[model samples]
Target: MEGILNILKPPGMTSHDVVDFIRKIYNTRKVGHTGTLDPDAAGVLPVCVGGATKFVSYLVEQDKRYRFEITFGFSTDTLDKSGKIIKSGPVRFLKEKELRQVLREFEGKIKQIPPIYSAKKIKGKKLYEYAREGKIIDIPPIEVTIYNIDLVEYESPYQVLIDVKCSKGTYVRALVRDICEKLNMPGYMSMLIRTEVGAFRIEDAYTLEEIKEKKPSLQPIDKFIKLPSVHLNKIEAEKILKGQFISNRHSIETSFLKLYDNNGKFLGIGVSERNKIRPKRLL
Candidate 1:
């Protein structure tokens, strides 16, 4: 009831759809998704339950890996298969080396424009909502880092599979669009599979059917949150829990830390500032 779930979300189900399923299975209202995954794509999505929901903010910042296919025939409104085709062109296959060279330009830091039909919010209103209402808005490009990108597989003149490792908030749909532009051809994201999210891998993720039929173990919150820990005595722990700051010249130079009790039990998270530590979040 109070742990994290690494779910293998299926295509066609939005991130919130998976959260709703988990809410019923666990019978808890305090369920949340770490980040939004596109409904047309499938892959590893982390879900937090009960007290673990407090750590959702941290999980959303983790890097991610994905495998996707780009079809070089036409482009769409959504930049994916889910959208209407806006333009069509003859398929021209690029030499493997040519494509690889183009991909290198995207490695490292680059500005990327998110798809309009996405869950990105503007003033608490989702971008897709505006798009559906036939409202025109200038979508801004964001800076995202692509740690590495490689040609996974090439399938003739129509489709090619690619693997990418990127920082948080990188949109694979936009990556495909950019790659096509560099080729001077039209393309759309044909398929997408998120292979990993931080330390969570697709192979280790559970599907909804598996969860409904089997009694699987829920992973501890500490399993994913990698931070230095500080142990406190009962007296100090009580004070920290009561929103009182403890002054100490701690050797660990971190802005945040995982707090633990004398018995080695996780006490939530603490923020360190000006040589004083205060509870940032508690279970």
Candidate 2:
């Protein structure tokens, strides 16, 4: 009951809605989701329970992978199919080579403007709040890295499917808008599915029905945390539990280490500085 659950989120349910459902299923209020996924999109969403909640911020920083479809011929106010159509035009087929070249321009680091109908904040207000009130605001662009973009399929003149690997804070809807603008065509996202986040993959995700029938097998906290490890004797483990610093004789080349006891029990996390290791968090 105190580890991570890789849940396959269903479309039309907000990320918080899934967390609430899990809370009720587990009958505990200690469950939380690592990040937010638009209600219209679906896929793998990792939920942390009990002590794992302390590491949720770490999981949020990891890279994410997504598969999405874009339909040409029009743009929407929300940059997705669920929005009002703002512009429309006839679709024109582009050569695969030309399309690939345009995608390349988005790879690596680039500046992107998020859609107005988004969760981004401005002046202590969500951007979508302003959009909902029929107000226009200048949205500033932010830098994000697109590690890779692969063309999965292209339907002549109208639809294109692609897989993208990107850093945190990337907006797939914004990406689709930019891609369409690059081609001098109007388009909007028709579908989106997050395939992966850090070490969590859709292949390992469990549906809500499956989770209800069979209790979820939680993943150990240490497995997903990519840090060097330090195994301690009972004496050292007790000291860490009391929030004490210990001498670091081993030259571990990392800022942080996953702490464990002699019997292979995960103790928690530790930070290293100047040959000294101090307890950062304890289970």
Candidate 3:
């Protein structure tokens, strides 16, 4: 049960709900999801089980790829179709050339203010909790990298489909809102599907029913973590397990390295900063 399960979260269930479902099936308390997907969003959601739960931070930080639809003419409280309409205005749909030009402007690093109805925490409570109470709070913008954002297709006059590849913590709904403002038109996200998250792809994801019926036949934790593997002898492996810093003759400059025993047992993740391997966690 100590591995990663790429769950195809249906639109109706929250990320927590999927985690709970896994927990009940496995009857383990250590199960957790790498990131949260809004209830209205259906796509790849990596679930960590057993010792894999300790590496949630690493998975959460990985970049994501999504295919989302941005619908023009109105804005919502949640910035998505799931929320109530907060404002409406004349619809001004942009042509493919104009939309492509506008999308190019977000190809690099940019600052983005998260939507008010989000899971981001203020103090100890989620920001969405405040929004539910009809409270307005200023959430500052943070630097996020949008590696690629291209106009995929336009299904209708008001709906523009886009494919986005961005770093972690990026809100596609908020991105739609920003792009709408750039076009001098208000909009909200109509549909969203996360295609990838790091090495996890949507194609490998399983529906809740499929998982419950098949049980856990998921990939190992190491599959979810993309790192260079370094084989270690018994002596080095013991040292690594004890959380001792080990120096190797061969120097490879990488932020982290995968430590494995002679038997090729996936030990855990380790940092190789300053030519010293300091073990971070033990699997």
- Write candidate 2's Cα lDDT for 33-73 as tens digits: 98899999999999998778888876898899999999998
The residue-by-residue lDDT of candidate 3 on 85-112, one tens digit each, is 9899998655788889999999999999
Model 2 pairs whose backbones collide: none
lDDT of 1 by residue, 17-115 (tens): 999999888888999998888888899999999899998997889999999999988999999998999999988767999989999999999999888
Q: List candidate 1 segments past 4 Å from native.
A: none
lDDT of 2: 0.92
Poorest 10 consecutive residues of model 2 by lDDT? 50-59
Better of 2 and 3 by TM-score: 2
Q: Give TM-scores for every candidate, taking all chains together and pairing residue i with residue i.
A: 0.96, 0.95, 0.92
Q: Rank the candidates by lDDT, best first.
A: 2, 1, 3
Candidate with top lDDT is 2
Q: Residue 209 CA error for candidate 1 (Å)? A: 1.3
